[model samples]
Each structure stands twice: as structure tokens, then as C-alpha cells.
Target: MTCKEAQNLVMDYINRNLGEKKLESFLKHIRECKECYEELEIYYMIHFAIQRLDSDEHASYDIKHMLEEDLKEAEKSIRRWKIRRSYRYGMIVIAEALLCLIILTQIQGLNAGSMEETSFYRLFFQEETDR
Candidate 1:
């Protein structure tokens, strides 16, 4: 496998999610590519650091509450984004309907003008024919 492919699979390899054959290929590429090897090492270090935090037995009640609050804020932000998107789509539909109405009205006005012109010409010709 190419170094790029191996790098892309590094997360799966670290998580033990890759099949045996693919894992072996990824390991082989990492062994041959110093850049990928270093990148994997850095990722492993970061994973280790986070794991260490998980193992910490001392947690304050305030920290737990703070984490919950942060999660609530994230949920609120997502909800706001969804609402904004819905409003934007609603506005677009309203605008399109208004535009269609305006266009139809213009077309109706043009047809009316054409009909009146045709009627005027017919009346004028009838007078000439009568004379």
C-alpha cells in the first residue's frame, strides 16, 4: 500500500478495526515510510494522553456539571443551526412564489394588450369595408 493509503488507515489500525490482511499491509507501509511512522507515533501519543485522562479517579462535581453544560450548549447550537436552515428554505419558497405571480401577471397584461390591439384593428377595417 502507498504511504498515503497507510496514513489514511492509521486510525483504523490503531483502533484495531482493520481486517487482518489490510492491517498487515498498513503496518508494512508504516515500517517503510518514516513520515507515516512519525505521524502514527504522534497520534498514538495523543490517544494515550486521552486514555490517561479517562483513567483518572479524581473528578470534581463541578467538572462533571461543567461538562454537562458544555454538551447542552453544543446541542443548542445545533438546534439553532437547523432552525436557521429551515427559515432560509421557507424564505426561498416564498420568494419563488412571489416571483412566479409577478411573471404571470406580466404575461396576463401582455395578452390583454394584444387582444385590445386586435379588436381595434378589426373595428377600423370594418368601417373601411362598409364605406
Candidate 2:
């Protein structure tokens, strides 16, 4: 196998994924060519590093932790909004109730003050005096 052929097959050889016939040819080339052996070592190291970074346990744990933190923040935001909404609704109800009380009191006051001379007591006293 030439250096170029061995270089092309380096990745498959490192992964042990080459066919038996190609594996044998690739190994023979590496044994005879110091340059091809070094190239294989370089490619193998790079592939291993990539695989380590892609490990399911480490990568998934980090991602899961971040998602959990985000969920917690979202829950906190929802709780804060609920509290504010409740306070706002409570304030609006109180304001409306106070407005109703004020209006009722004003109407009662108008009826009481407007009945001075035309009131029932004044008319009844005047009729008795005339009789």
C-alpha cells in the first residue's frame, strides 16, 4: 500500500472498521512506512478526542443541567407574574367597591338634604294646625 492509500484508510483503520482485506493491506503499509504510521497515530488521536467530547454521559448531563435551570427560572417568572396579577385584581376590586360606596353615600345624602320643607313631618304638622 502506498502512503496516499494508507492515509486515506487511516480513519477506518483507527476505528477498526476496515474490511479484513483492507485492514491487512493498511497494516502492511504502516509497518513498512514510518511516515504512514505517524500519520495513523495523528488521525487516531484526533478521532479519540472528538469521540470523548461527544460522550453521551458528559454532554447529556451538561445539557440536562442547563435545561433544568431554565425550567426553574421560568417557574419563578410565572410565580412572580401570578402574584402581581392577584395584587392588581385585588386593588381593582377594592377601588370599584369604594367607588360604589361613595356613590351610594352621595345619593343618600342628596335625598336627606332635599326633603327639608316638603318632608312628611312638615306637611303633617301644617295640616294639623289648619284643622
Candidate 3:
């Protein structure tokens, strides 16, 4: 068989698709032609490597997709945590403001009480001065 014929039959030979007569002819050509033999070897290696790569392709895609989903969930969890922290901070500020308002009101009441006592002193001093 010619090199071209042998090259054409390489796939059939690899897959065991050739009949007995074609198999013998294909082998005979490969043995006689060094270039054809090398070509067959190259094709065989490529076919097997491609098959192996395909087998792992599905698993790799699955792992990649799972990781992406996990990342999204993690981001969502972080967002929720930030929202809760912001709400807590807001509530703390409101509580502190209310506490300050109460303290100011009590101070004002104290000042009003002291003003009444001062007025009594003013009236007694005026009577002394008039005498």
C-alpha cells in the first residue's frame, strides 16, 4: 500500500475497524515507510490525549461552577453582615442621642430650681438696703 493509503487507514487501524486484508496491507505500508509510521504514532498520541482531556473537561467545569456559586454565596453573606452592622451602629447613635437629650432636660430643671432660691435672696437684700 502507498503512504497515502496507509495514512487513510490509520484511524481504522487504531479503532480496529479494518478487515483482515486491509489490516495486513496497512501494517505493511507503515513498516516500509518511516514517515507514515511516525505519522501514525503522532495521530495515536493525539487521539488518546484528546480523549483523556475530554474525560476531565466535564469534571473541571463542574468544579469551576461550584466554586463560582460558593463565591457568590460568600459575597451575599458579607453583604448581610455589613447591613446588620450598619443597623446596629445606627441604633447605637439614636440611643446615645436620646440619653444626651434626657441629661440636658434634667440640667435645665436644676437651673430653674436654683433661680427660685436666688430670687428670695434678692428680695431680702433689697429690704436691708431700703433700711
Candidate 4:
């Protein structure tokens, strides 16, 4: 087999999943090519490292620990921002309500003062016309 073909079949050979003819071809290539042999060794080392972790009950813990920490920090920051935004909106609402109330009060006071002035002018003109 060519080096490329053998390299492709190396994983299947290591897992004992290759057919008899394919296995023989892959093994022949391994025997002839030092580079392919070393490549296979490195592949086996990585495979074994993963396999060793496979049996550990806490494998998920190690895998997700950093990600979970980051997620929690992100959630906290989002919540803090949301709370700050809500307080800002609340303060704006309150300020707008107070401004509306002040305007309404001032308008009512001006209307009452104008009515009193108009009544005083009507009374004074009626008395002068009678005289």
C-alpha cells in the first residue's frame, strides 16, 4: 500500500476494524515506512491519553468546569446591567411624572387667578355705570 493509503487505514488497524487483506496491506506499509510507523505511534499515544480519561467518572467535570465558570460570570454581568438599566428607567419615569405634576399645578393656579381678576373688573364696571 502507498504511504497515504496506509496512513488512512492506521486508525482502523489499531482498532482491529480492518479486513484481513486491508490489514495486511497496512502492516506491510508500516514495516517499510519509518515515518508512517512514527506517525502511528503518535496517534496511539493520543488515543491512549483519551482512553485513560474515558474511564474517569469526573471526566465531564473537568471538561465543563471552565465553561461553566465563564457562563456564570456572564450571567452575573448581564443581571447587574439589567438592574442598573431598570433603575435608570425608573428614575427617568419619576422625573417625568414630577414635571407633569408641576406643570398641571401651575396651570390650575393661573386659571384661578385670571377668574378672580375678571370678576373684580366686572364688579367695578357695573358700579361705575350705575353712578
Tens-digit per-residue lDDT, 1-131, candidate 3? 88888899888866767765676666667667889877877776666667769786543234334433543554455567668989999999999997986676566547777533343444555556646
User: If ranked by lDDT, best first, what sequence of candidates would result?
Assistant: 3, 1, 2, 4
lDDT of 4 by residue, 55-118 (tens): 7644333423443353345445556766898999999999999798667656665787753334
Stretches off by above 4 angstroms in model 3 are: 57-131
Better of 1 and 3 by TM-score: 1
TM-score of 4: 0.41
Q: Tell me the deviation in Å of residue 28 in model 4.
A: 1.1
Better of 1 and 2 by lDDT: 1
Highest TM-score among the candidates is held by which one? 1
lDDT of 3 at 101: 65
Against the hidden reference, what TM-scores do the models get?
0.42, 0.40, 0.41, 0.41
Query: Candidate 2, 59: how far from true, in Å?
Result: 15
* Alpha-carbon local distance difference test for all models: 0.66, 0.65, 0.66, 0.65
Would you list the clashing residue pairs of candidate 4? Answer: none
Q: In model 4, what lDDT does residue 44 have?
A: 65
CA displacement after TM-score superposition, residue 11 of candidate 1 (Å): 0.7
Writing each residue's lDDT as its tens digit, candidate 1 over 60-107 gives 334434434543554455567668989999999999997986676567
